[model samples]
Target chain A: MQYIHPKAIKVWRIHGMISAAISFVLFLVLMLLGLFLFRWLLYLAAGFLVIGLVDFLIFVSVIPILRWRFFRYRINETHVVIRDGIWFVKHTVIPMARIQFVEAEQGPLLRAYRLAKLKISTATSTHHIPALSIGQAQKLRDRLAAFIQASDVDV
Target chain B: MKRAHPLSIFAGFFKELKQLLLPIIIGALFGIRHDDGMSEWFALFGIGICLFFAVIEWWRTRYQVLEDQLYVKIGTIFMKERFIRFERIQSLHLSTNPFLKLFGLVRLEVHTAGGEDKAEFALPAVKRDEALRLQERIGGSNRSSQEDLLAVLDRSENSERVYRLRGGELVLAALTSSGARVIFLGLFTLLGQIGELWDRVSFITPLRREFHRVIGVPLLEAAAGVAAVLLIFWLLSSAIAFVKMYRFTLTVREKDWVIRRGFFEQTEQIVPFKRVQAVKIRENWLKQSFGYASVYLDVAGGQAGDGASEVLLYPLIRKERVAEFLAAIRSPFPWAVPTAAVSIRAFYWKIIKYVVPLAVLATILSLWVPYGAWSWLLVAASMALSWLGYRDASFAVDGDRVALGRREFSKETILTERKRLQFLSCRVSPVQKRLKLMTVQSGLIAGNNGYSFRICDLPLAEGRRLYEWYITAYTRSARRELQRVDGESSYSL
Candidate 1:
């Protein structure tokens, strides 16, 4: 069993920064409206600013580090086991023989971090491994693909 | 390779035209209202392209069976050849639309393993005899699954009919089914074309005035509206059921079980015995009281929209006759009878889970509005149902098979073989963990997606045992055979 790439923490923080940027823009617009249009709306602007700061401290800084510690996955000969989530935890085990395909994809954020997301699909469900180094993700995909090809079709 | 009947060229044309209908309709509408000269030409151009593709597609598409492989070559621009080995082929279905039937042609859809949202492909226009011959040739890949199939045929080679939904039973099944949804769909469609339908049914205007006069009270008006919807729903439900389930017959033969159903555009689905993943028996309160239940078979392959869903074994059958139906499909299952009342914790948890929240809401309503105290009756009803739910829900493991029975608004019983399970999962939320409870859930590939059987609020130890029971062999095998994932892979992700 292994935790995801530590770079995932940085990615989460980058994601949080983008969200903070959007909220800052919202704050500016709301404050302007409060000053010019509706005088009482300054209270809403103040509340939103406090929420954004608290969110950055607790969620952006603290939760990502906790998340990196909790998220773990292990792939074996017969099954893939995933133990994930800090809040709403889940443990999923998908049979190796039942997997239809293994795919690797990268979003702009993941691409910048040189990381990729692996999607392991069965006949019914798709399970995700959030972030892995690009080369490692491809290696896992190939190894899983070969394993799937060698295994009997149970689905 | 052989070409489809020439008439399919016309079918192809119409198929293309059907896809382009929205644009054509829009064009026609524009032509009629705005006197746009381009609108008529646009529709005509679209029709011309449709006709061209129809001819090209029909001409280029050819299919054949040779050396135990069903091969199809399609595409007009860049030819693509596809083949399915007889062993890999999952199910064989034959269908005929009225237009194709006019030329004595049937469409054969060959489904194989790997769930992609449809039958692997369809040979649009083959003869009925040809389709049957193709089905006969695909004897299925697995020999272990065939011995029982052979025995079934040996017992009754000449007699193919297992069960047929007779007219009365058909009507009863339809009546019991919730057809109100179909009528609601119809009402939305009618509302979509209100201007055209509203003008023709001018009688409704006078009837509305009469209703306004007689049921002047708001509550009575709502009551009348509901009664009318129910009346229309009953009529529409029966009609749809009659049309859909007309001459619905389940027949079996050597390799595959064939279900021939539908009044118009008749469909015949041939499912290989090995494809069956599990058996599900569902009984609502009314059906249970009547000693009747519906049996559904969960098959492994084919897309959901391809009408390859949980194939209905029997729409309605007497509970006593279930064993007879089961015997036809596969070996007789050990029907599990629950032993005792539900656990005290789960029974009480059901109170906290359902009744408590509902009771609080009811109390609020009772304190506020006029006659709102009636909400307490609903709270009482919810508590009763929850009790019934846990009391009836039980699971049993007998040898290599497991039978789970759960009762919600309906009683659902699922019987699954150990080998057929894709994966077994145990969900334990934080609250459930504190309560020392977990949910045991298992999945099997069926229809477009799959079917999952879940039983909740089991003791943590019990759930762990079940999870271990499912994966113990695999886990041991995994450790012995593979230690492939090693070292840096652990630290990387």
Candidate 2:
């Protein structure tokens, strides 16, 4: 099993931070509205703030754990496999021969780390594995292309 | 040879202008009646818009073929550049209205078996003789090109033959197919409107009141009345079949299948030999009684719309004639060959599998709501239906050909070559794992329709066998080409 790059945690953290900020602002507005509308409702606003904090903490903690748990990739002479989930694990195996195209994408956060996400698309569906070092992504792409050409030759 | 009428543009312009006329007239009326200058201005604006469109159409409407490709350049500001290669071209269609016929011209549409978005290239106003000459030249060149390619490839398979349907057969075929249902639906709507009008006019008011008072009928009597109404409906539907399918005909010419039908607006479609992906022979319970079967070609790039088959090769034919038709077309598959019937395990699995889901839903619904017993009845009906479907399902492998038969409301048997499969997958679900079974889905590259066939619940060994056959067939087909390029290892990049 190949571990997803640690830099993937940074991408997830960026996503989580955006979500947290939105929720935090909403919480602040609701609290202010409750204080103006009803004295008793301020207690409900406090409870909501506590729940938001807990959710933010969970989101912050889970990203790194998920990055550690997930493994994806292509093996020589075989399909590309992405194994994920802490429980009720999912393993998606897409044959290289079926791959129509390979796209390497870099979002803003991933660009900061110089990491790219490799997306493999078949005729029917697409799968993505994010935060790979540039060198690793290139090597994987070369191997995938080689496998695809070999299979096409055998077609 | 019929050229698309020079006046055809005016007809189109008039049609478009007529569509816009409603808003224009409404605005004009509003302006005149309400004495509003703004409405008058809006009406003038509409006229300006219509004239602008007419001018644009006049400029960009002309089409001419150059060399090996048909080019159709249309649109004004957002210009469309369409090219249809002569080799990729399947058929050139000529259609004309009475006005176009008067002008000795017809609309020419070139169809290719490719992307749905880019399949048709149309020439709206071509002379009839020129269009015919173009079709002949393209068709002739296409044949010779294939012959040359075959010689180079060293394959001497006989060229495909085209089939045509006779007028009587075409009518019969259309009548037996879903065309009958469409006619019935139309008539039913008409009758419903008449009935509503009759009720409004107080003509049937006294009769309805009398009938209601006389309706102290028993439960069984009411059930019998319902059955009688259903029987009358069925008779009405069959009557519609006779009227609509009055003059249907199908024809085969060389390597093309032609179907011409319609009571009012006649439609003709040609299906080329190469475009047919699979031939589906279907049967239904009623068809068995009538000694008739429906044949459909799974032709690429045709879409069924409303109630019409996009490409109607042969609407309805006797089962015995299927073999002769197949032989005439040089269809690669064996004609109506018997295949292995699905195991009784198929029946049991289908029933039990459906029952479990229904049972779960029934338990929940019964626990939380009324009419719980009815939910149990629903489960029973579903299980029965699934059992019937499973019993009707079967598949066969005859040499290089695979035939799959699936029966639901209608029975469909699809015949395809192993090499045509774009991809094959063997899936073992958790339930299938427990049962030592697997499902094998075979996909053909069918443009926008995507993967065509999904076969499920085969024994693991059988699924593996099918998968191996697919891989072997594909590899064998390409082996010679690969061997020729043996030393060129740099192709991987």
Candidate 3:
């Protein structure tokens, strides 16, 4: 098993923070609405404020480290095996012969970090590996494509 | 080169009118609101335009049957032509309702694969004989050898009838089908109506009094009402099933299988062996108790039936005779080995997984809602089903065939060949890791786009073995000779 690029932790923190920010902003709007427009929203908004604060603290300080520590993946001649997910720890095995397509994607954030996400698709399911070094991702893409003979693929 | 039957003119006119109906209605309404006497003429003009287009289209559209393909030409100007190779044609469907039947006409549709609700080619109206001739011509390309035809015909065609619905089983199948929701709803409605019936008919005179006197007890009255409703639904559903599957017969000749059935609207479906992806044997709770199951096939090509994905093969059969039926049809997939069972500990896990959340919901409902105490019944039901799931769910690998037996409200047995499977996977969580348990899943391309079979709560080593078995080609054939489907077996038809 191989760990993802260490920069993934940074990506994870930013991703988490962006979501947490949305909730915190929603809390602020709810508080403002409760103060001016509706009476019942005051208690709900106060509860949301506490939730938003806890979410901010957890995403920035706790989740990214745990996610990075747990994520592992492996690619071999016959199958691509991945062990992921925070709580349930889903393990997936996709046979190379069944792979329909392989793709690599990079957003502006990932581009800044020189990282990419590798997506592997089978006839019925899709799997993704987030935040791999771009060179490594490209090498993997090419190798998997080369190994998957057109004659071997089946729907 | 030829044009469709003359009735196509009417079909085209109706089709064009349907598409243009809304605009014409709106236009006529505008005229009427303004108190214009010309609205009638405008409507007539719209109809005339539709008729004119229909005539032009019918006259221009022509089809030329070639040696091995069908070429269709459409439109006078800006003409578009399409060539559909006979070899690529997957299935032929011919159908007619009462109106078409009165005119001895049927709608013919030729199909291949991939598109939804769109056939490769369609002739909206054609004489029944011509449609049959075209079907024979196009379908013959699959097994075209004259010698093969002679060989199949030389033997008895009746012997080729692999399976047919018996009179009793046809009714039995309808009775046990998944109309359970309707049954509960009907029962509740009938119960609600009993009080209303007593109140309304209390003063309606002798008929109500006479009926009440004959039945006497209110309990008996309720029971009779329930029985009457059940009987009516049973007969109604059975009548529907009978109309569709009357005299259902599956006949095999070489590698192709043909299904012919129906009472009022006859249907024929031809499925080539290579197109079958998997076979499913479904036994719902009711059917399981009755020792009956229905067999369905996941066919890959052709928009075959009422646009349904799974094709009904055997609508009803004794669960034990499924193997015999498969053998009779010479199916590539044969049921053989008994599937292994998950451990008792898996039941505990299943109960925890399903019942815990349901129990919490039930508690909250009981605390807050007036009638929420009944929610505990749901929890009890979930617990029982989970136990059944643990007792039944498992997987097996024999030669090139893999079998998955699972229970989720119903027990379904999915059997498929290795070459048809898209992929395989195994998964585990932290709890499963401690318990040394895993779930195995496999995918196959089906008419429903795709279907994945999941076998939950297998021993960790067993799940790994099933996963490894899919990728390991060398070991697959080691026990090939021992496969049950290998030897030719004879059974009473």
- For this target, which candidate reaches the highest DockQ against the unseen true structure? 3
Q: List candidate 1 segments past 4 Å from native.
A: A1-7, A33-51, A103-118, A131-153, B1-93, B97-103, B108-161, B179-218, B303-306, B331-334, B337-393, B407-409, B451-454, B459-461, B477-493
Error of 3 at A141 (Å): 2.8
- Rank order (by lDDT, best first): 3, 1, 2
Model 2, B316-369: lDDT tens digits are: 667878888777656646576635445666666776678888999998988887
Alpha-carbon runs more than 4 Å astray in model 3: A47-51, A150-155, B1-92, B96-104, B117-121, B128-159, B179-236, B359-377, B474-493
Instruction: Evaluate model 2 with DockQ and give the value.
Output: 0.16
- CA lDDT scores, all candidates in order: 0.69, 0.58, 0.72
lDDT of 1 by residue, B336-453 (tens): 5544234657767788989999999999998996545767866887887687677666666665577777766778887776656766777777777777776767777676577666
lDDT of 1 at B348: 76
lDDT of 3 by residue, B1-493 (tens): 8888888888778867767865664344222333566767877898998788778777877898898999998874567898888876655666665567789887777666556646766776888778767766776885422222332223344435567788887778777775444466556655566455444432323534555799787555555655655665556566667778888888786766767677755665666666688888888787889998888888774445456667887788888898998888878688754467567878888877899999999999999975567679779989988888887777788967888788767888888877577766677878887888887777776663676768888888777777777766523242232233324311100
User: Sorted on DockQ, highest at the top, how do the candidates line up?
Assistant: 3, 1, 2
Provide DockQ values for all models, in the order shown: 0.30, 0.16, 0.35
lDDT of prediction 3: 0.72
Query: In model 3 chain B, where is the ten-residue run with the lowest total lDDT?
Result: B484-493
- Deviation in angstroms for B256 in model 1? 2.8
